[model samples]
Target: MAYAEEYAPTTADPARIGYALVPLLDYFEGKTLMYVRGATCRGYVEWRTSMVRANHANARTEARRTRTVSSATARKELGVLSAAIGFWHREHGPLESVPVVTLPAKPEPKPDVLDRSEMARLLGGALGFYQLEWCDLETRQLHRTLKRDHSAINRHTARFIVIGRYTANRPGATMKLRWMPNTVGGWPDFKRELLYRKGSEVVESKKRQPSVRLGRAALAHFRRWKAIDDRAREDLARRTDGMATSFLCVVHWGGEPIKDIGKSFVTALDFAGLPRHYTPHVLRHTRVTWWVEAGLSLEEVADAAGMTTQMVEEVYWHRSPHFQKRAAEA
Candidate 1:
């Protein structure tokens, strides 16, 4: 399920790599006439075949060997040139499969966890600069950028990040803008309807949807963010109507929505000087780790993170090796 982001791992046959790349063939149909008139030769055909094969590196290698192009130069041209030729041939008939070449398995790397001190530094760094204020050195451009223009956009971003990090929802499930406004009403509303009801959280052929309540400290931080959002929206004519009709998150600011916020999380983390891996998903992992360290039952952490208890135990339970080692030392 996690591998869905990289590949369509759900396909019944994994051997036909880019089995999902099948549907994309339609897009190339428009380019058919241009390719048919272009260059045709042993070198071009070999290189072209490699491009269609799916493994990018192999395509480059085949192109270099066929054309006597240097290894370095071939890599640059492989994707662009090979793709052009491949699209041309797709209209005529099915291309032959790339020869399967298996390499010996390498040792898998162990997963690493941040120590408690490192975790403290990350959260501290994030909060220390949460209220964004921009300054221009040359002109003294001190302006309140958080004005009436983007209030709805900011609230939506806050809600998705808050709910996704707290709940560990998959991107598809959590990024759906329709469900967000109801969830952001906070824990009381969440607990009354979403939890205890079995199917309330579960989507068909999709993962269980858990309702996550923030910690006392996290809730305090969120309340501060909400206040800022409210002030930003206050200047608009008829602010109450704007709040009532629009979704908490919308595409008002530069045509961006809350769903686009995840990309910006990495840039924000870089600004805060935290490790690059400290993205929103890392916060999800950190929440689960803290619950386990605090002696919450595995089942509780799993439900909170929208996963099976076994997954939480398998992924994060070993994070605090010091606690286990302390028992033996004692």
Candidate 2:
């Protein structure tokens, strides 16, 4: 892999190189062929983690690679450190021996889960938002020559809430939903598909080609939302010509993608009379619990949820009546 000549630093070239992390970033971000040494050789693990926590604050407002430096953060940071040091050691024998880097123990915390009734309230809230938006649009475009139906709805935030509940996808993953259609050559656009990645960049976590499938209810709602987007395309064609794609959760009554739906999510949860601690992630937990209660094995629930069986067992495993009955029968 060729390095970006302008950005890369070398030993012969003593240019301060800014944060001392500029060299290692090429390795982490897949730039290639940059020399990082000195403190890295002596205390790489600590330096790497500290650099991650301290360095990335100014550049981005959100979605930073190292915003939260937890133990898992340490694991990935140290993993990269190990890889870089190992590579350097093999290519050029500078250090006598590589110091051992210890990774943090895996965390096992109890998951907060939503019951089915709470799930319904969340979906109902989304549908209500859809209807509210549709009504607002109808009031604005009332004189326009179009047939009106009370049943017609186009909700985005609510769909996200409902889909997240059933798909067991991480909130971020579900937000990556697109509008791929079921053409003659292919299946329905939304299925358990690989999360899109660019170039040689890698997922730092074990997010191994995470896949999420919409259930029948979520699929139905998704189709309705697409229809709403299609109608929106015709009406707002001049403004949104190149803007349309398969983004499932769009801003209400428009073609814009909803990147940060935290406010809306919180609003929905609050409106549904749920706790603030019941974050979007709890949807996945709720799904896992439902799967276990429905008597699915840990492996089955893990595969469906795009997580490990160990994670499923550790955090979400609970013996429901069905599982207990089945156990007694056996």
What is every candidate's alpha-carbon RMSD to the true fold?
Answer: 12.9, 11.5
Off by over 4 Å in 2: 1-99, 124-154, 181-205, 210-213, 238-253, 320-330
For candidate 2, write residues 205-258 as lDDT tens digits: 454334445567766766777687777666665566765443333334356666
TM-scores of the models, in the order given: 0.45, 0.57
Q: In terms of TM-score, which candidate is strongest?
A: 2
The lDDT values for all models are 0.43, 0.54
Per-residue lDDT for 169-254 in model 1, tens only? 44444444331344221222323333111223232222455555555654554456445544555544265555443323321232
Stretches of model 1 off by over 4 angstroms after superposition: 1-202, 222-234, 237-247, 250-256, 277-279, 320-330
Model 2 RMSD vs true structure: 11.5
**Cα lDDT for residue 54, candidate 2:** 50
